[model samples]
Target: MTTSTTRQPIHTSPINLTFLGTASAQPSSTRNHSALTLRLGSDAWLFDCGEATQHQIQKSAVKMGRIEKIFITHTHGDHIFGLLPLMAACLNGAGGTVDGADDPRTQVNLNDSPMEIYGPLGTRAYIRNGLIYTHTLLGRPYVVHELRFPGDPQDGDFTHLPPHRSESPNGRNIPLKTDLNDTGTWRNIYSDNVLSVSAAPILHSVPCVGYVVNEASVPGKIDPTKYIPDIKRTKTPMSVMRRLQEGEDVELSDGTVLSGPPRRPGRKIVVLGDTYDPSPVASLAQGADLLVHEATNAHLPGIDPATKETDTYESVQERAISRGHSTPQMAGKFATLIDAKKLILNHFSARYPGDDDVNEEARKIMEGIRDMASFEYDGPVLCARDLMSEDVVLQQDNR
Candidate 1:
């Protein structure tokens, strides 16, 4: 009897999402403001850095240094007030020195890896002006990339005030796709070997944007037991085996063919800022593993026992839309339109405190919001709270 050799499959880290804050324009005693972190392995990406975001980071498991990129939906104070402070802290080495004390690497290479910040048209002006007016100097270099839509101000048009003495403004402004009318998706804002991020213009009071993070699909695992015998029989090189594992079909001199398995799809996460409508992102965000949408207002009866007044869903929804926000049902409708696997309602109003554990009324209100969203979408719904963490599961293929 011959023994079949088996090889170990490569392991990839799961993407974990942590909500640093889940408040709307006004923050309550429990919820801080709008901020969240998506952690993949050792690195993290921050979305919408609201007020007290750096302080919230201190309370969570996410490290400041690991946040390589920051994405802002708009320039609202509640969504961007924490950016300068966070950058300043990073420059101060609050997370730690770029290189370890005993490590041979030097900090001179810090400029090579500047932190990346992405946002709407005003992002560049906001950061640059903030840095200049506040006199907050970042020790390390940082870059800001603005996403401008059609009809926006052209470069050097003085619509966006230029920053003085800010060395990192590299004129890296990204514009909308010429075929946006047909595709409805913006240009891929950021991409690396592991992950790619894209954005779309959503309906808000200001120029707001929504982001979608897509992890690279990985090569499927191979059954070493089935291929090892053929490889040994045919005297095939180990390099051929590697090629087969990388989704390549290999043919040996003996006319034996080795076929690779199907690739495993990576997780997709859609996160939107304060927007009444986010349908523009549906094309890019379809079939997402997780959808994070704002639920700024909802009609929950008895939420305030003192008043004994119940606001109808239609009435509250009108108010939410007028303010360029979304209700729970509207968020659910968007999730359903995109066929999202899971939905998380965030950016709650201050009226509904997110202290589920400490306050029973708050917990009931949160549950009511989830229920309201569930009415439209059949997926699992979760009401976001401060410091809440969730792991996005990988989508597997049976083949």
Candidate 2:
């Protein structure tokens, strides 16, 4: 049976990932640009809104309106070409209903809450200029928050034109705190009740950042059997049970104190954009349940297949580093260094087609990349494909 990316009613998993696009600098026949979405409870957070991302979302199960927050690793065209179009669609009430299905979650009503966008320097100018030149007027408002690092572009210099008569204008772009912590991590780029996102500077040709999504720990399960007998014997109010589950010690009339166990730790998901060395974010991504790293190019040990040249691991690594990208082995090494439990390789080169099932050569190439990564990181590694969905199940907290 074919799986679906549609949100299920009963499954309230904290972090669910859907890979919208997995191509690198260029897109291929089967792959679009780089894009992905994480469904955190009711709201969806999008990362790297690449070209044709909206079309990819339409084909997937992710709804449009649920994408409340968008995080851009950089202002590369392949990473953010879809931003303006997506915002326009949100305002025009287009691209909401998939296959003519009427779902309110996919629609953005008039004067709906603004979409918050977080990105590296030059993001504000990109969004502001795109909207202005395109003559686009989103009925709904949106806000862009730029993250500036030292030596990066100066902030608060971009000016927005006065709103057109029919335009839904929003406030000026807000620049986040650029100060880095002791560990060099930008703490709490965004935080809410469900989860928090952090970022760190990464090595790239242009200024780039990687993000870490940490789900909030939840209360541990309460054993009703242990407390039911005490409740009946002491005639204690059942409200005390609620308090106990909330990690509070409650004393009954008979002086019986009930203490809940420690809270269960949530899952950690690390997602990085194109980078040669992503170690800057390693401190924040340690022991991640899922590490989504880029493997843009890999060595295929053969002569005269496509490039008519012999390939070696060292040669490929050197080329990838020069281009500000990562090979499968490099991605694996980083995952192993960070102690990631599972690794999903993404942002593949266009040379390797994404539709592995139909192309035997592509399938072998992808498998070869996975094997190369496994050589460094002794963990499960998956090559991401367009429209692929991953359900991240948090491990049981034995401690």
Candidate 3:
């Protein structure tokens, strides 16, 4: 008797998302302003191209030709000021926009495609205005799809207010409520067949958004040749194996059935371009495999590590809310609230020099928060730095 064991082949494509820049409002010696490259397949999703992002890219393995989508969270100078130079240089290398895409490629070469810019309304006009003043240098076409929210930015979250607010006569400076402005309101940004993007407003002075990118499930591969009948069974040709790998389940006249293993999603990454509280982004970021939160105010090393578990540790939550960015403690709390598997806090303020300060701060747990008053969800936390690349993929267990 012949025995054949089928191993459900799990093929995983490693996705390496490199942090090109991770500063919030300003760039310091330890950190640069906002910029990130989401390596989804061969394409790259650029979030908030701040000043010097192109320079950062040049220093990394990110091929300048691979950047496809540039999603600007807001028009803030720190978030999008560097767009002009990045766009111009990319276009110039690809040729001119209106007349540039015609570049012919040799057998081994491929021409760079138009870069898609995704942002708020008037983005096209803003880029054009910048380009108009600058000399003609690039010729690559890019389309900006504005992501306009349903409501205003500065208004408090109307969805989270108690229902009794309406009953109160002439409420005391309480803001109006709306489900659209809820803490967990997530809006689907983009989707094709396999992958989709969703985003929600993060706590920021401007109309900023934190995005969640998700890829669809992929079925596992099966070995049809293993299902061959035992009566004088013959080895199937390589062509047959290829077809089976393509999900062509088949039954032979000899009564053999071939099947594949269970299917599952690739992975989930909760990447925040630049945010503070990010309470509004909870819905979109719920159950994220990884949370890349902004840790603009982690100054932990100044304090002793023993104080992390002690009652004397001061919480940075208030400072985070006031500054419109998150502290390490707040970032950890946000990650825990969203059921994230891992928390990576970066985007430090220029004030803190060297990542030792960042590591010290993020590691310093908030001793100030009393358990009775709130839920301080603390999980695994790590700080992010520019030029650092991390691997993330959705596994079946994550699903």
Can you give the TM-score per candidate against the true fold?
0.87, 0.86, 0.72
Best by TM-score: 1
For candidate 3, give the lDDT. Answer: 0.61
lDDT of 3 by residue, 179-283 (tens): 655534444456655566767667676667777877666665564446434312645444555555555565554667655455555567777756666887787
Candidate 2 Cα errors over 4 Å, as ranges: 1-14, 93-112, 159-183, 237-240, 302-304
Q: Write the per-residue lDDT of candidate 2 for residues 1-399, one digit (tens) a residue.
A: 011144333123546899999999899989999999998777788999999999999999899988888899998999999988887776563322234335443334435566778888777668777766665545566766666776655546355654332232443333334454355566776665657788888999898989998877767778878787888899987877878776778787899887876677678899898899999899889989999999998887652156436657788789989999999999999999999999999999888889886778778888988999999999999999999999988677522
Please report, as a residue range, the 10-residue window in candidate 3 with the lowest summed lDDT: 165-174
lDDT on C-alpha atoms for all candidate structures: 0.80, 0.79, 0.61
Task: Return the number of clashes found in candidate 2.
Answer: 0
- State the weakest 10-residue window (summed lDDT) of model 1: 1-10
lDDT of 3 at 307: 31
